[model samples]
Target: MKRQAYRPILITDASRSQDDQLTSRQRRYVMMMGVRVACVIVGAALVGTRAPLLWLWLPLVALGMLLVPWLAVLLANDRPPKDRHRLANRFRAGQQTDAPAMSLTAEERPHKVIDGEP
Candidate 1:
């Protein structure tokens, strides 16, 4: 019997390491939080100095403060979507359900006969 040849995965098809994904998510979370901090600073500065259109500015800044952390947590915890090819088998199986499996009768099926000589 012949052994099958080993196949190597391509670098282009490889997914990122867990550490790399965690590092990227951490960076994104920090950047968004930094923006939230900026929103807080601006709101405080506006309150202290009677800025123009304070009502509008305050609500917009307040909205940023309310939404950023929620979004940051969601994004930070999210992982990348599965590759499309990973889902191909499921779709192929679904398509096959449209057709009923073929069945063969005993006479229609292939068979081997053996004869013994006395």
Candidate 2:
């Protein structure tokens, strides 16, 4: 049996690639906002009802509302905020424009041998 040498795949320019990457804080802020909004709506519904669950819903709703400001602050305090333009420029500078498509070929690809070690 003959061994076949494998060549590495290279991307020449990555700047032109279209991809979305959000920082941790940004993702969290978005998630928190969505949850808060849902909570507010639910809470309002509970408050308007004469059901005994109003007690529970009101507090939950209030807590959710309270979280909005805190979440905003957290988002504001993010050490490195997400910047789409900057990230795009960086992608361009790094020559990573068109990213590879997600497929089994990517996941199942064999690892390259380094330093001639198996």
The top-ranked prediction according to lDDT is: 1
Off by over 4 Å in 2: 1-22, 80-118
**lDDT for each residue of candidate 1 in 1-118, tens digit (9 for 90 to 100):** 2333444445866788999999999999999999999999999999999999999999999999999999999999999787887455446853652222234446654689887975
lDDT to native, each model: 0.82, 0.62
lDDT of candidate 2 at residue 20, scale 0 to 100: 30
Provide TM-scores for the models: 0.66, 0.41
Residue 70 of model 2: what lDDT?
Answer: 90
How good is model 1 by TM-score? 0.66
Error of 1 at 48 (Å): 1.1
Worst 10 residues of 1 by lDDT: 96-105
lDDT of 2: 0.62
User: What tens-digit string does per-residue lDDT give for candidate 2 at 1-118?
Assistant: 2333453444543233222323555677777888888887787777677668677768767987997869766775555545575456437754765434332244365678579765
lDDT of 1: 0.82
